[model samples]
Structures are given as structure tokens and as C-alpha cells.
Target: MASEILAQLQAQKLLIVNPRRKNGLIIYKKYYAEFAGPGAIVGGQFDCDAIAVLPVGKISLIVPQTPEERRQAYKMRRQWVKLTKQITDNPIPAERAQVILNQFEHWFDAQTVENLPDEAFALLVGVLPQTITKVRNNGLF
Candidate 1:
């Protein structure tokens, strides 16, 4: 599932930066990457506890390891809030945001490759378009 998501993100030209260990054990610590238009910066991390997505600027959607990790994530969330605000404050066009979200959905879908039930597949088909609309309207990049 992760590989599929990784492929989609890569296909979209999003940079994927994974932390490496000397033992060649891709420590599932943090996997982060980002995609930007002509002049944008995107990056993120997947750690022992969470998967973080920082598309533009520093705003992030962090999926933590466990309920306990939420406390630590709170600190990271503050940083993301500051970064996201900066990205949104920029003079980027609205259309650009849509492009980013479209890529994000592709990535999100990839993340669920393993256990995607038939019902979920239908739900995704129905929900994705609306979700994209909401993201576009909200200018969430």
C-alpha cells in the first residue's frame, strides 16, 4: 500500500525524502516529501509514530503513531500551523491549490492500498470529488 502511494506521489513529481540508517533498514521512522509548482517548497516526514504531510510552506497533516503520540504531535502541529499560514498567505493562484489537492488524493488513495474494501472503493469514488471541491474552495494546499 505504501509503495503504491509512494509511486503516485513520485509520478506527480513530488519529492520523497526518507531517512536512512546505516544498517539499510528503512526505519519506518519518518517518510516525508513534497511537491511544489515552479517555485515552491514541499517536504514532510514519516516517523515511528506518524505520517506527516507538508505540501507548501510548513502546514502539515500529521497522523501520529498512537494516542500517546498526540501529545508530542501537538508541538509539531504548532510548527505546521505557522508554516501553513505562510503558504496560504502567499500570492499563489487558486488553481494551483486544486492541483496540489488532486495529487494529495492520489497519494491518500495509495496509502490505503492494502485493506481497501469494496465499499471503501465506492466511497472514495463518491467522496473524492466533493472533497476536492472543499479543498479547492478552502484553498488548502
Candidate 2:
């Protein structure tokens, strides 16, 4: 019965929305993990350890994309990652943490910043989860 419902939705190109669902899958490689979000394509990763999805919060739209869309998404994602790397590449951990926090706070509202998972944010910023906790906490981490 559930399968029938899902099939119907999928056929209609409707993505399942888990209000508590995450926006991407984490492709865990040997040493680190990368994220595959909307418009991004993840494939040929047979040797990777595993692809773990986030606990549940953001919406991950896993679907096919046109070649043009894929190209655009790839460019945007690459740029975002590169910028994050630049920020995290800072020698001083304190400065790196502050920059990431400010960026997120600007991209998203303060509440959304608080809602983001600390571990994911830490991974993106090349910081430790504890650092994220300290930086993102006021109401909580």
C-alpha cells in the first residue's frame, strides 16, 4: 500500500518531503565525507565506505537532472566547497570558526544557523564538533 503511494508520487515527479529530512547524503570516503545535495549527481562510488544521510532536517531532492542543470549545480557546489575550504584553511582555528559562523548566520537566519547540525558544519569548515558547539551555542549547540 505504501509502495503504491510512493510509486504514484514518484511517477508524478513528486519528491518525498520529510519535514525532518536532511538535504543531502554524505559520501563517506576513506578519510573524509562529501555531500551530495539537490542537482548533484553521486555515482560510481562502489569502493567508498558508505553514503550516510544526515539525521533528519533539511530536504534532499534526489532526482535526475539535465546535463545543463548538472553542470550548473556542479559549478555552484564546487564554488561553495572551495570557499568553505578557503575559510577553514585559515591557520587560526578561532578565526576560521568565526568566519564560518558569520557566513552561516548571514546565509541563513540566526535560528536556522542554530538548527544546522554541528558535525556537518564542522566538517564543512574543517573544524572540530566541539568548536562548533562552542561557537554556535547560546540557546544550545
Candidate 3:
């Protein structure tokens, strides 16, 4: 049987993510990836191209959002962007990859990134997935 990624839901409208309960990923332009970890929100700002669940643990769904919940979601997205800007802005590919792993390590095991295909990272930074492997393997892999 084909293995399906869990919770590949389309955002017909805004979809807010609650990271304490659900970890999610939003894919943009078919390649660039945004991870929604604890407190992050995906479709809140705009409709997402695609969103899928990360198997972090038993999952929970987003409830109807309150004002405070929306605020938290927006705040997390800002933090998420701030975190990855380091990767996207840097000219060095290997250095960009290393910075992303360093950021991920602060929240979760850097190895948990294996949950997503290496190609995602490749596309995100415009490098070969092999580059991600080479950089990731050097430490905390």
C-alpha cells in the first residue's frame, strides 16, 4: 500500500496551527518549506499551497481561534521567519544549511529533520540534497 503523509490538508481558508498539539509543514512554490513548530501558524496569514502533519506525537486539531490564539499564531510566524532568514539570506550554501540545523537543534533533535525529504531543504536553499547531508553529517546528525 502507498504510505500517505498524515494530515495533508488544503487551506481553503486560513488554518491556524497549535504546535503543542500538532507539528506541521507548509510548502510554498512546491519547494520552499516552512516548519510550524510549537506556537507556529501556517495558513493564518495567507492560504497555503499545501500543509502536512509532522509525526511528532499523537496529534490534535486547531480549535476555533480566539483573539489571543490568533495573536500567538502571528507571533510565532514572525519568530519562524526571523529564524530562517539567516538561512535564506546567507550566500554560502553549506553555511546556510549549517545555520538551519543550528536553529532546529534549539527546539528539537536536528535529526528529526529526516522526517522531511532532503530534497525540500535542497530546494529551499537552491542546493543539492547531498549538500544538506554533507553539512548535517558533520555534527549533531
- Cα shift from native, residue 6, model 3 (Å): 8.3
Candidate 3, lDDT over the whole model: 0.57
TM-score of every candidate relative to the true structure = 0.24, 0.60, 0.70
Residue-level lDDT tens digits of model 3 in 41-82: 555334335544343323344643687887777788778767
Backbone clashes, each candidate: 9, 3, 0
Off by over 4 Å in 3: 1-9, 21-28, 51-59, 139-141
Residue lDDT tens for model 1, 16-132: 222121110111214222222211212233222323222222222223445455444444444433543443453543433444444434544434322223222222222243444
- RMSD to the hidden true structure, all candidates: 14.3, 7.4, 4.1
As a TM-score, model 2 comes out at 0.60
Judged by TM-score relative to the true structure, which candidate is superior, 1 or 2? 2
* 2 against 3, candidate with superior lDDT: 3
Candidate 2 error regions (>4 Å) = 1-50, 55-62, 137-141
Residue pairs with colliding backbones in model 1 are 29-46, 29-47, 30-46, 30-47, 31-46, 32-44, 32-45, 49-65, 59-84
Please report the candidate that would top TM-score against the real structure. Answer: 3
Residue 69's lDDT in candidate 3? 82
Evaluated against the true structure, the overall lDDT of model 1 is 0.33
Over 1-141, each residue of candidate 2 has an lDDT whose tens digit, in order, gives 323323333344423222233344434444444544444444322212443434222544544446665556556456555767788689876566678778767654577667767776667666787887876664222
